[model samples]
Target: MELFFKYLQYEKRYSPHTLTSYHTDLGQFSQYLEQVYQITEPAEADHTIIRSWILTLVQNNIKPRSINRKIACLRSYYRFLLSQQQISVNPMVRIKAPKAPKKLPAFVPEESFNTLLDSFEFEKSFEGQRDRLILEFLYGTGIRLAELIGIEENDIDMRAKTVRVLGKGNKERVVPINDSLLSCIEEYLQYKKSEFSDNNSEKLLVTNKARPLYPKFVYRVVKKYISLITTSDHNSPHVLRHSFATHLLNKGADLNAIKDLLGHSSLAATQVYTHNSIEQLKSVFEKAHPKA
Candidate 1:
């Protein structure tokens, strides 16, 4: 298991959060095996036992995506065992994962996004400037919450008006920034410099004390600010990302272009935004049409 984690960190270059998730999932599976069947080795596992474990997970009300992730972990572990000649066959070869339900991505309407931005008074105070820039950057770039928090000061290119994002698999992509967002970022940086003249932290976003931003902080910021402007129940960094993609799609942006902007590995991953757009269109049609 330690070797597998090393592989994920060094060779696969998965993000630390993802590596942690994989570790947790695999650890739970190992504990289950040990507690239920006294199985201490991957080689001793068989398909029947694997299937039973999955059944138990289902009975416990685990979501299909999570179950599929556990199955993936098992497959990787067993495949590694096979390569080492520790197992004669992979038991997961014939085990099928349950189909994941297609969930529609939630997004704030364009008016709501604008309302949230317009609500920022942009006082010279550090908190005001920082909050404005944080929300602007999230909407403008369509970056994931994790990616946004991981951004370093040097990652932003003022001249090029692009931010270099280190995405999943340690892949890097440059996302262009709008001129308004660029100006906001500039103002925020100036405020940061004035406030933290003695401190030299490199993170793009930081707390009042100049500590780096964490995931929960970002979430709360989004929730608080968005709740003030919009009545929608769904308001988070991811909803901002979804809104970004949906707005672009509504404006006739190329699907592949949107995919690159979102840093999705494949077009399929980015295509969910199209479904949201279609649903919006359908609503419009139903409201406007005079058909009986």
Candidate 2:
């Protein structure tokens, strides 16, 4: 398992969060095998044993999506073992993953989003400036939470009006920044420098005390600001990302261009935004059709 993890880290260049999930899923499966069948080596387990585990998970009311993820983890591990010649047959080769429902990504309405950004008056304090920038950065750039957290001072190219993001799989992509977002970033940086003189942090967004931002803090930041303007039940950094993509598509932006901006590995992932676009078209048609 350790060797396989090292391979994923060094060769596959998987993100730290993805590595953690793989470790947790494999760990849980190992524990289940040891406790239930007294088997310590995953290679010793056959398809029947794996099927039983899946049945157990189903009986325990595990969500289909989560079960599918676990199955994926096992599939990857088994494939690694096969490549290494540790196992002659892959147990997961014939196993079928359970079907999971597809949920449409949630986004804030354009009117409410614009009103919040334009009408609200944030305080002059460094915290206020930083908070407003955090929300705007996510909504404007459509970056993932981890990507935003990983941003450094050098990532922003002020003269070029672009921010370089290190995305999943250690891939780097440059995203364009509008004047409004760039101004906010500049203001936040100035606030950081003037208020926290002794601090030497390079991370773009930080706490009031100049500490680096974390996931929980970012989540709270999104929830608080989004709640103020929109009644959407789902509010998070990803919601802002969805809003970015959906809004762009609504305005006739090309699907492939949005995919590149969003740093998606494939167009399939980007195509989901089209659902929102189609819904918008339906709404317009219903309101404008003369026969109605």
Candidate 3:
């Protein structure tokens, strides 16, 4: 298990969050094996025993998606064992993933996003301008909160209107910036530089006391600004990302283009935005049709 985790971190380049999840999932599976089957080694496991374990998970009312993830973990574990001559056959060969429900991601309305941005008065005040720029960049770029917080000053190119982002798996991609956001970022950088010059902080966004921005701080900033303009309870960086993708899809952007812009690993991941577009189309159809 330790070797597998090392493989995930070093060879596969999985993010810390993904590595952590794999650890929890695999740890649970190992504990179940020890407690139920009295099997401490991977070689002692077989297809029937694995099947019973999955049945137990189902009986416990675990979500199908979560069960599927556990199955994947087990499959990977067995494959590793096979390579090491611990097991000859992979038990998960014929196993099928349970059907998962098609649930759409929640996104804030465009009006609400606009209101959120407008509610911010970006005066020369250090905190005000910093908060406003953070909101602007997140909505404009659709970058993940981690990527945004991890951004260095040199990652942005105002001249080229592009941001060089290091996304999941440490893969780098250049996302374009619009004119308005370009202007905002430029002004914000100037203010940030002047404000933090005495303290020598390299991060793009910081607290009023010249500290690096943390995840909780970013969430609070988003919540505070969004609460002023939106009545929705879900106001976070992820909601902004959803809105960015949904709005692009609504504007007739190509699905592949949206995938590249959002830095998704697969087209299936990007397809979730299609559901939002379909909902919008349904609304337009119901409102415009004369035959009721």
Clashes per candidate, residues 3 or more apart or on different chains: 0, 0, 0
* Candidate 1 similarity to native, TM-score: 0.93
- Candidate 3, 187-262: lDDT as tens digits: 8878777877787777778888888898899999889888877788889988889989999999999999999999
Q: lDDT tens string, model 1, 192-269?
A: 999999978889899999999998888888898889877888988889999899999998899999999999989999
lDDT of 2: 0.92
RMSD of each: 1.9, 1.3, 2.6
For 1-292, candidate 2 gives per-residue lDDT tens digits of: 9999999999999888789989998998999999999999998999999999999999999999989989988998999999999999998978999988998889999999999999889888798899889989999999999999999999999999999999999999999999999999989888889998888888888887788999899999889999998776889889999999999999999999999999999999999999999999999999999874
In order, the Cα lDDT scores of the candidates are: 0.88, 0.92, 0.84
lDDT of candidate 1? 0.88
Pairs with steric clashes in candidate 2: none
| TM-score of candidate 3 relative to the true fold | 0.87
Which should have the higher TM-score, number 1 or number 2? 2
Ranking by TM-score: 2, 1, 3
Task: After superposing candidate 3 on the true structure, give the runs of residues whose Cα lies further than 4 Å from its correct spot.
Answer: 122-124, 198-201, 207-212, 231-233
Query: How many residue pairs of model 3 clash at the backbone?
Result: 0
